[model samples]
Target: MIDLAKVDYQVILLPPSGGKINITDLIDAWTHEEMEDQISAKVTLSLKNVKREDGWMHQHVFLDKRLVLEATDGNGWREIFRGSVKAWKTDSENHTVHVVAYDPNYNITISKEHYYFKGGKTAAASIKEIASEQGIPIGVIDGPNKPLTKKLYKNSIANTMMERLKESERKGSGKYIIRSTKGKLSCLKEGNNSVIYELDDWTTESSSDERSIEKLITKVKIYGNSKGDARPKVEAVKTGKTEFGTTQEILYKSDFDNMKAANEAAAEILKEDGKPEINRPLIHPDIPWIRKGDKVRVNSGTINTMCIVKSVSRDMHSKKMMLQLKE
Candidate 1:
């Protein structure tokens, strides 16, 4: 329950063999930025009055060297970021050493490869195979068991990995996140009811809500495996929402060739996404442990609901964070 607490942080250099070098005493300031939209999470630190070329950092740290950032409120150290150094700069006049590091995703985003998976690969398996081939280590990959077929992708490993993860969306498993954490790749299912964290009154500063109609779809036009110019063979039970005008989504599922199954699926998709999306942003005391894809429960004056964390923006110095939650 550390609210607006005095936060102390450290920057550590992790050697290849093992062990860690404490760079906290030498650091002047640091910042961290992590988001689902960004390809890689990043940490930037300033070392005070270190040698320009022959400093402790310059001598031991090289590209791909591990850098870890942690913070404490006297409750003990909590790791916030672990990444490989990409580049650095030495400020001679300012008497500072500026270093920039990013998660392993930085390496994946620069790599271009052609991938061809014959058929019958689950969403988790598909991304694991690609990450494995690219030499990235794998963590827990909890995804839906829907078997995909013939996933051919040609792009940077980061982009293709995201594309492969899109297949995890289905009825059984609602959504999945393809995240790289602590030098390991993971495809985790979103919104776990078992591990719901609370943004209670103590740590929550303020909150606001907004609405988005972008994903609202009224009617769904389902297409079968028929050839070109063929009309929709099946129609959903409920047509467009005439009250709010018409917003249509065409569902193309070759397996939905049967009329009954196609209509049911169309209605199901509409039921799931047909409503206006409510986006809530809460100003919470910065807690680095809260992560994207984690479910949180909130109960305020007329607001009582569970939500999935869509994004988090943290200020390392101020211990303030803006958490974006999805409905």
Candidate 2:
């Protein structure tokens, strides 16, 4: 970035007899050596305490005839000017910085004629009038009447409304809705009912049941007071049989859905054998199958006696066996 404070130049004005000043000439000078082609340079002209008929002293930077930066003491920094920097050029001597200003009115002007190296040689005039005469647009810097393209204005308003709606939704004051038409979908909200709607077709036809508008609101809201990392807290639940060999259950104070999900997951794990195949419970067509906490008679390889099913196991080898009475 080129420092504006370091760049040196002279300010000059056109002779009264000279035709309208050419803004391009000034832009070329400021950006001559630095930019390959004519480019906008932010040139700040400081007019300390000098008052203009428009009731203010102005400091301004212009790009070509476009006013890119401007300030005034009259409006107390509240009323200022704005424009684009089109391009810059310099005089034959390379001593003056000629700036062009484009106002909100679409008027283009060569506002500053000659910038002189020595301060006192430059003529004094109302920056606003100079801007106006040069066809440079004048406007309040931070004023509400600043110009905006139609599209920009519309989009800005829409964004602002959406922001307000999101704020209301965070407070639970409104809901989100979706509407679809001919396969096109639009999501919006209704403030009166505090509900959101999803419509099918622009005709308000809904393909699905009317759901709470909040449900349609983006699961996460962006750009508002609700703008934070508010995430749902989850607690891990212990599922399956406890160390004591008893089925375990957990009662969750919050997140009932999470609790249900945990239970389901645990059930899946229990379905898979936790022990080796040799210790897994055996399935037989003739012998009665005994369940946990059940006693049964067993006869296997000289071992014949009654035993309780302590546990069972299955391994990747696909073998199954039961833990009979511990000898």
What TM-score would every model get versus the actual structure? 0.81, 0.15
Shift in Å, residue 200, candidate 2: 68
CA lDDT of each prediction against the hidden true structure: 0.71, 0.27
* lDDT at 170, model 1: 31
Where is model 1 poorest over a 10-residue stretch in terms of lDDT? 164-173
Identify the leading candidate in terms of lDDT.
Answer: 1
| Total backbone collisions, model 2 | 52
lDDT of 2 by residue, 1-327 (tens): 112122222233232343222222233222111010111112333222233443322223333333322212222222122334444444345344344432242221121133112211111122233334544333321111111111111233223223333322322333332211111222323222222221112221111111122212111111112226765343444343333344333323231123443344334334332211122122221111222323444444333444433332211111122232321
Q: Model 1, range 167-217, lDDT digits (tens) per residue? A: 435323467776667778777777753656677776678887788787788
Error at 258, model 1, angstroms: 6.9
